[model samples]
Target: MLLDALLFQLGYNAALVMIGAGLLGLAAGMAGTFLFLRKRALVSDAISHATLPGIAVAFIVMEAFGGDGRSLAGLLIGAICASALGLAAVTYLGNRTRLSEDAAIGAVLSVFFGFGIVLLTVIQAFGYGRQSGLEGFLLGSTAGMLRSDATLIAVSAALTCAIVLLMRRPLTVAAFDPGFARVSGQRPDWAEAVLMAVVLAVTVVGLKVVGLILIVALLIIPPVAARFWSDQSTHVLWISSIIGGLAGYFGAALSAIAPDLPTGPIIVLCAFGLFLVSFLFAPERGVLASVLRHFRFRRDVHMRQGLLALAQGHPIFEDLTLKLLIRAGFASADGVPTDTGRARAAKALRDEARWREVRGDPAFERAAARYDGLTDLSDVLTEDQLREVDARIGPPVGAA
Candidate 1:
């Protein structure tokens, strides 16, 4: 029964809506990679909030003109206009005033959202027809999504994806280093404009499925989560898109089954869940991985230190440390250095002496400071040069 409900029992409307939401997620995730790289994640929040007043105003204008006040086209047109204006305001404020991009984003988000609330109030008091559904734009309501709405979302998402793919190279260059891109004769401003357009399109389409408040999460979380898994921007982009699409698909499916839950928050929660998982378990970067790496590094350092002490006839501090060295073949059962252990200890002491000398140089102070508490000196000093230094100075006093 459960399997049938999941695979075969879904009605046509539910399937279409789910597909549309998934596509919207895919586009948002793709475009969001650039936005995340550029550190413009909050721009989507500003644009989405700014669209609220535009939606209300569009409905008012349509009613005044004797047309359907709830026309999707008219509402989307208003949303675009308002979102553009908000973008312009953010750019202007950031460039012309002392306000930074974050400050400008906050200012625009609050003012525009407040104005939208006022407009919504006016519509409720004096508008001719039902304005009840208009509030859905704030929190999102996918229940009323029609086949036409789904088709429109799919088309918009496809176009956005195509544009991103075509502009990938220049966009990536600009995203990482605008100055270098300009030096290479690429117009970063043009690339930024194109990116903003893509963000606007995604934001506008997402309003119905995820709503204005939560749509920014759709844009920001997937890329951030993907970043935990890879350092390459190309890998991040694909992973982010997959995570976003899955979030949308599964969230919509669950909502369809429940029939009482809101789709927007569920989608956001799914993305958040993925982010949390990545934060904890991603190889090399996740919290658990980082902790394990630190533990291994500390253990290695202690073992190397104990080997040096044993070579110099110094006291070995811990029984466990000695056992670890023996287990690793650096020492014998009697806690004496083996042939390999003596050579390793000599090299370790020599490298440490070289590292100390290099770190003391004024020229290397800054660079050496970056490796505080590091056990291996081989990374900074080559074996050939360290051997030369060892020949000249010999190992430290007791490290023979």
Candidate 2:
């Protein structure tokens, strides 16, 4: 059953819902990347929560006017208007007053969400006409959706993705380096406005699919997950979009497997699963990679120290260092240097001497700055320089 849904073997309505959800996911991922980069992701939360009042008010107004209050278009328009107002308030408070943007987001998020909840309560209490489906907007419901609603969602989501792609360059520049963007003739203010506008559109379009309550996760999780896969900005953008799309498509299908399953939370859970995989296994930045790098570094440190101790005729007391030396064929099991060990020890001793000379010499200051104790002297200097350093230390006292 899961496989069939994923393959779109379900009916036409199910296919349409899947397409709409996937597109919404792509737009959210792209738009979310900019917000994450800008450190203003809370703006999406404020706008989403703010749309609730508009939805409730639109329903009441439509019912009073003797029109179908369940119209998707009317509800969305109201959501847009209300969200715009909320965004403006946040901008005003953040810029015109001492409160920071984050603080403004927090205030707007709490107040508007509370007011929206109150409005929802009023509607239920009064039993407004045809108010059966309004609660669907809270957590998203695509089950038994009209064809027009699905089409509208698909088109809106596509347009949102197109707009985000068109403006990605400037948005990225503004996010990473506003000063550089200014120098390049891109107004930081305009870039900020564009980002907000994009996020607003995503929130509005996503209301019926991912819902206002969980939409911010769609915007945030993909980009964060993609970060684990690559350091390049461009790579992250495409990777995040792909992850978001997969989550949406799979989540929608999985929801169809059971009568009680919802599309929104399922999508979020799918995204989190992807994030978990990236966090644990990504070759560049994952937890496993970090652990392996640490172990390799520790081994290298032990090997270097073991060789140095052998060169100086010092007692090797560290068990790990002795193990490393023996494993590398540098020392006998009894801890005495083998012929190969003696050669490596002499080289390590001379390298240390060369480093000391270079560090103290004014002429070698720049080269010395790159020095680490583990680096061989031959790697850092020419034969002439090595000879000069070796001459100062005289011949090796214990040469074979």
| lDDT for each candidate structure | 0.85, 0.89
- For model 2 the local lDDT of residue 211 reads 87
**Which stretches in model 2 have alpha-carbon errors above 4 Å?**
358-369, 377-399
Tell me the deviation in Å of residue 311 in model 1.
Answer: 0.6
Query: Could you say which candidate leads in lDDT?
Result: 2
Instruction: Pick out the ten consecutive residues of candidate 2 with the lowest summed lDDT.
Output: 254-263
RMSD (CA, Å), each prediction: 4.3, 2.2
Residue 389 in candidate 1 has what lDDT?
52
Q: In model 1, what is the error at residue 55, expressed in angstroms?
A: 0.3
Judged by TM-score, which candidate is best? Answer: 2
Q: How far is candidate 1 from the true structure (C-alpha RMSD, Å)?
A: 4.3
What tens-digit string does per-residue lDDT give for candidate 2 at 1-400?
9999988898888888898889888888889888888988888999999999999899889888988889999999999999999999999999999999999999998899898899899989998655558888988888877889999999998998899888888898999999999999988878899889989999999999888899999999999999899888888888888888888888888876763666789899999999899899999699999999999989988899999899888989999999999999999998999999999998888788778888899998878988867778788889998898889878776656
Q: Give the C-alpha miss distance for residue 282 in model 1, angstroms.
A: 1.0
Query: What would the per-residue lDDT of candidate 1 be over residues 1-400, giving only the tens digit for each residue?
Result: 3353346367788788788878888998999999999999999999999999999899899888989887777898999999999999999999999999999999999999999999999988885666547887776677867778888888898889889989988889999999999999888999999999999999999988889999999999999999999999999999999888878877777777776677789889988999999999999899999999998887877887786686677878688788888888888888888878887777666666677776776665654775554456566656775565556666465443
TM-score of 1: 0.84
Q: In candidate 2, residue 66 scores what lDDT?
A: 89
